[model samples]
Target: MSHAQHAVPRRHSGDTVVVLALGLAAMVVSMMQTLVVPVLGIIQSDLEVTTANVSWVTTATLLSAAVFTPLLGRFGDQHGKKPTLVGVLLVMIAGSVLAATTTSLTWLIVGRVMQGAATAIFPLALSVLREEIKPEKLHGAMALVSGTLAFGSGLALVGAGLLTQGSDPDYHRVFWLAVALAVMALAGVLFAVPASRTKTGGRTDWLGAFTLAMLLVLLLLPISQGHEWGWTSGRTLGAFVGAIVMAVVWVITESRVKEPMVDMRMFAHRPVLFTNLAGLLLGFAMFTQFIGVSYLVQMPEDVAGYGFGASVLAASVVYLLPTTLVSLVGAQFGGVLVRRLGARVTLAAGACFGVLGFTWLSAAHDATASVIGAGMVIGLAISFGYASMPALIVASVPAHQTGIANGINSISRSVGSAVASAVITSLLASKTIPLPDGMPALPQESQFTLSFTIAGAAFVLVVAVALVGLKAAHAPRTPVLRKVTQSGTPQSAEVEADAELV
Candidate 1:
């Protein structure tokens, strides 16, 4: 038997606990990413920060995620997943405490930075799932875990809305909620997850990690902030150029390193490449639904000539809650699809659902039931995307490379989301409906239609990626060469085992 077999622990009673733990971790990570979205205004007022400074509350977390995700993912591969997971969760807890207790904007940003490091948890959780679950159950297990991410983000919005709905609410309650969830995740990790069974066992590739971090930060920064910086401004354009340059540097550096942080070929391999592309499009679609619907529903209908006139609380609990519930169901169903059909087919179904969902949302969102029903469809699509993308990664990469491979895929989705945010913000801003006096302008009805149409187009791209990119992936083997270690060894056996797992 190869190392991969040995690394997979014999099944036990504790596996369920571990799965629950991993599920919790996935949800918490997703929640942290969006928890503050609905409460930025409250945060600004409470912290007495300017809009730009308040914006960093989100920006800081995104940047920190870019910095830490790759590094810790590599670290988990080198050192130990359990330790890395514990350390990250602890840092997140500390960060949550600081944010909950502090009144200072700088400290809050710092706390957010700390919380952001926990983004590593998702990849690490994936690595654990790869190691601990039996092959027969692996796809469904991963799909289920990935599915949590969908409900998690929506739950964050609803939870935040609820916490702040009271007459006198504290913004700190948000972080407190984060604190409680992180602690629960930590407990699950401590008791349920086994010790790391496989370590790549090598010297850390600090150079590759640094270059990749720089590349991601540079690449994601402008995507996330271009609207604020003015897309045509030198700052925005400069960051894009810098990101491209850094990409070249990082690629070159990875190729030369003795023990590269990532094997470049793993990235270009058809299944991996297309899976990441699908991830990007799905990510964009997910956020497009989120921002587009949230913004659309919240506009005061009586005043703006459109929208549901929903409050923040109503938007989360009423307009968007069904999507959250349906996503969990979709994720379970996605696992069935992956197990019975294939990740490729599962992804195609998701993409098709996305197209249909957005079409529904775009053409007939005038009624409450129509909007809610459309959101559930989109939510189902997102759950399927989450469920299948990682399964594709698992089938392609060796066990030791799981952390970094999934980490890169995770970043791909983040990039998609950042771009979606910028695009949606720009689209909404570009056209405004005429409002009566003393009313802030609302996005014109046509912009929402245009946004949904564009998002549906992105899913159309995913259908191509799923069908074409993953077409022959079911054949004998992954096309990329194995990542060679300093010992000049190739993990051919591991790859064969991985394909079997799929």
Candidate 2:
């Protein structure tokens, strides 16, 4: 009945292949986000750079991803998803090669910036799934893809540990592994994904894109660096002020643009607004487990009075890996829940699990069994939260707007993570037990308690946001248009749809 409906092909046998290919691509790109965490110290030593300079290997990638992801998503919507996806994979491969081959920190940072463009792959892949998969199967496929992202992050840490083992401990090997995976992903996407027929034909919104980039840079730069550069320092404060100013200008620019990069009005839509908020809170809760548990297991028992002093490899394999593996299971369960209940309820349940998990960790983390149990619970929460987000967003927006909408949602999650990293670091560093004259200080046990409590509170807030804000928002609607496009006018469709897919 509508141009979009006619343009969308019926589900075919190849759809499964497409999902697998795109999921692999999403996993590989997600892996790039955390691959360097276990090896940052080694990279600093090898590159002959200060701790501050070496941190840029991760920081640059963060800033770059924040800048590029939304722009690329918008571009994919305007042009074609398959080509854009393939191009992103190619850039990622090149970046991996450059990082693997180079010894210079500057060159490696450059390579990481290139790799950051791959952040768009997840949202673009979702858009493709919407176009290709049967509606019945879409939720499960998206859940699998989303779960793999969390799985790949943990897998990367384990993979990094294995690759960097032995006295030689070659850090370059990590990037080489990334190169191999990217090549595989590139081939899979090129071969399996069909060319996209749906295109939102519009001129690229360069001004809107630039303003948004500046706003994100201003917001993220301080969040990532505030711990290193004193929080009260001029640079950090100036960046915050600049971000506020830039955000205002961005709002004005977006309102005026005929083809805006992100639709400003979407922020007012109850489902979109609250979904983004819940994403931010869940993102914070997720990172608390990631950074908190990793540091907790590694604390020296004699010095800190509460840890196993685990190595990176042991932490990955023993403590964090099991939880990550469980998350895959949780993701599948979440898909079933979304079909049976709805995204809002699924999200609320996940948030409740988060609150429970973190509360348990905060109270009883003395034994390995307790830590593992809490980790698994949080893992389940993370999987369910991640799975429900895309479903909520995809169900809320039109098919054509899926890419950009999810892109903004992704940015919200990133912002939360950046804040979580900064806040948790600040909290842990706030009060430390003094050691012998030459020994470095260790965080007091109470700091970890405070951190977990704060994270649990954030999850509690998510539960409230979902129940009150999202539930009261407008109901979901089908994307069918009332009338087909005529001449140059755009087709109009009801914004409400049947929310139940199960």
Candidate 3:
């Protein structure tokens, strides 16, 4: 191994403190994403909105987050993460304030769009840490950060349930709590985090941004509304056509632009391409697990589900355990695995776990134990792959491009989820076979069994792509293994004359 490939400086006490704060902030923001779920019924009645319209509160946030995450990530890369984070928190605060006062579904959707800015926090924090933290500490920091996206949201559902129980269900309380947390996070980031090393040099890609925005809107509109609109309707068909045309145009325009929003040339790198392919699959498979298993456990027992008739709190708590627990374990073990087995093996292992877990879920439909086991498998699998993909992407790209590269990777994942949620939900809802006299219209066993099967197939497909398509290409010049004497910064070094001899 090259000396530049050596360990990072020993983490100091302050490093731990800062990482914990980042994790906490990320957790809070993530929790806010789903906190409204338990209170949706109340909000619908209060706002005089249909259940479908109220659903947009969540959908708006997700859509905005998907479309803007790459943009925010690039901004962070160009400017500094600290400022970007402060900006994001401010947006969330504004969103909370707006949501708290909202009396209509339209305003609620607007508030959600504002709040969606917080989703950028996860990627921004990771990008910031890639520069500041040692490689040794990166895994743990990232795991906690990523895991927050799961656990924090789950916890938020629980908290929302507890707070909203009985007496009039003051749903606004959820946003108020989120507002408080956002304020605290902003303060902590301002005090604790340092400025980024990156300096914005190039002109902004306004055209590219416009193109991407149009493309995303076209794509997501169809996905989000296809079921409601009738898939074959002119509106859905028109949107689909527009999305295709916009996407193709984007490719051509981005390739020709001086400062493109997405750096298409990066895809020429094998590992980068492979990582992105894996990301798409991972996103589809992993997200489906959440939706599938939740429905499974909460479905009434008579229909062959776990029959928990689980409240939002009970279901979230039960489902979230595996992700929260395994993420910690995955973070600790990932670095060691990288050191010993290499990044590819670690990633592949995670994919394997996904396949196993989802497959079992498809087969084991009638029991709660089966549901719990499936959750554990899926959680462990995602943590492993999620932890490895970022590391691999970082190792491949230039230092300055890490944030942008990862941003696109993040976009890929989001797009995958957007696609799956659209496609899977459409399929699952398409058929409403008559219920048996004793059972619900759609049997719980049939729904989840099919969902899990679809998810498992997606995972297996990704693994196949990774295994068959990805191989080591020419390695990037390795960094100097030793820490810099001047300020203790990490730096790359030239290979020794005899280094290839080893």
User: Model 2: per-residue lDDT, tens digit, 89-147?
Assistant: 99999999999999999899999999988889999999888777767777888888889
What would the C-alpha RMSD of candidate 1 be, to one decimal place? 2.7
lDDT of 3 by residue, 17-110 (tens): 5677787777875676668866888888888878668778877877787667777877776666788888988988898899988777788789
Compared with the true structure, the alpha-carbon lDDT of candidate 1 equals: 0.84
Q: Sort by lDDT, best first: what order?
A: 2, 1, 3
- lDDT string, candidate 1, 1-502, tens digits: 2233334334455777788899999899889899999999999887777777798898889888888887888889877799999999999999999999999999999999999898899999999887777666777788778888878888999989989987777889989999999999999899889998777767778999888888888888888778788889999899989989989999999898988888887777777788889888888998899889999899877776789888998998888878877888899888888878788888999889989999999999899999999999888888888888888888877667789989888888887888898899899989898767897778888999999999999999999998887887755243333333323444454445456434
Best-performing candidate as measured by TM-score: 2
Comparing 1 with 2 on lDDT, the higher-scoring candidate is 2
Candidate 1 at residue 414, lDDT?
Answer: 80
Over 4 Å off, model 1: 1-13, 436-438, 475-497, 500-502
Whichever of 1 and 3 has more TM-score, that candidate is 1
TM-score of 3: 0.87
Please give the distance, in angstroms, between residue 386's alpha carbon in candidate 3 and its true position after superposition.
1.6
lDDT of each: 0.84, 0.86, 0.70
